[model samples]
Target: MANHGPSYGLSRELEKKNQARFSLDEAIEVLLWVENVTQLPYSCDPTTCQNAADVADLLKDGVHLCKLINRLLNNGSRAPFNPKPKMPFQKMENISNFLEACKAYGVAEISCFQTVDLYENKQCYKVIECLRSLAAVQLIMSGFEMESIIWLWKLATSCEI
Candidate 1:
């Protein structure tokens, strides 16, 4: 439970290796893509990470994540949950809800991440992978041909919110 970075320089090398997998740029792109697909009541900007505790801070509450799942699952017109989470446990519940929604939407279990990954600010790449997978699923369902899949992902990554 003590994931506040390396305790000392002894683990710095290992920490750096792990940090290399967390792509802040990719995370932002995923967040922006989710934002573009859903009709969020809140204007949670993904680019505010310069002051955020974690890249997933904007999604820490899990409200938008649920919305993203709802959108991906073709439930964009309705809310999967109604909790206005403020407590830590509530935030965790939202994350859990998002994961459940992912499973329901046919996302591979391997692509889904654990709650602590986002809640504790760890393993951000997992979150991005899940989001990208969801986006791909959404795009493919929307009639994108097989050849366009690669280009679609590149387009989504290059797109700005």
Candidate 2:
């Protein structure tokens, strides 16, 4: 059986605490950047998203995510991993590969979301955090200011504004 979430008492309160940290605007930004970077196959207009749930739905399959990472790493059309996985296990495999690539691309292990996180909407904020980390690392590698990125990370993780 799958753990949907706690339904009562202290555990429920803790579960509620884990909710609502994600920003729709930042998620849109990440989606736009991904669309721009990978030219996603479908009509991806992230601006239309009303909430983080929408973003989660878009990325649940992990195909676009794989393509985004592939474009960043290879800068070509060749897909070394399975580009389109039909089964649940295969899709999870793609997400796993994507996580591994992000780690290899300088995203720390602690900063990454587990496959189930994105797949099951367990903690969607971590997905944005991983993407934000990837963007920061990529920018730093390309000679961007590290201090600014640090500030952004701090701002992102901090409580309220």
- In terms of TM-score, the best-performing candidate is 2
TM-score of each model, in listed order: 0.76, 0.79
- Candidate 2 pairs with clashing backbones: none
User: Which pairs in model 1 have colliding backbones?
Assistant: none
**Regions of candidate 2 where Cα sits further than 4 Å from its true position:** 1-6, 41-44, 74-80, 145-161
Q: How does residue 49 of candidate 2 score in lDDT?
A: 85
**Candidate 2, 46-100: lDDT as tens digits:** 7898866688878877788888777777444433456666777887888888898
By lDDT, the best candidate is: 2
Residue range 38-65, candidate 1, lDDT tens digits: 7664455677655224566777788888
How many steric clashes between backbone atoms does each model show? 0, 0
What are the RMSD figures for all models against the true structure? 5.4, 4.8
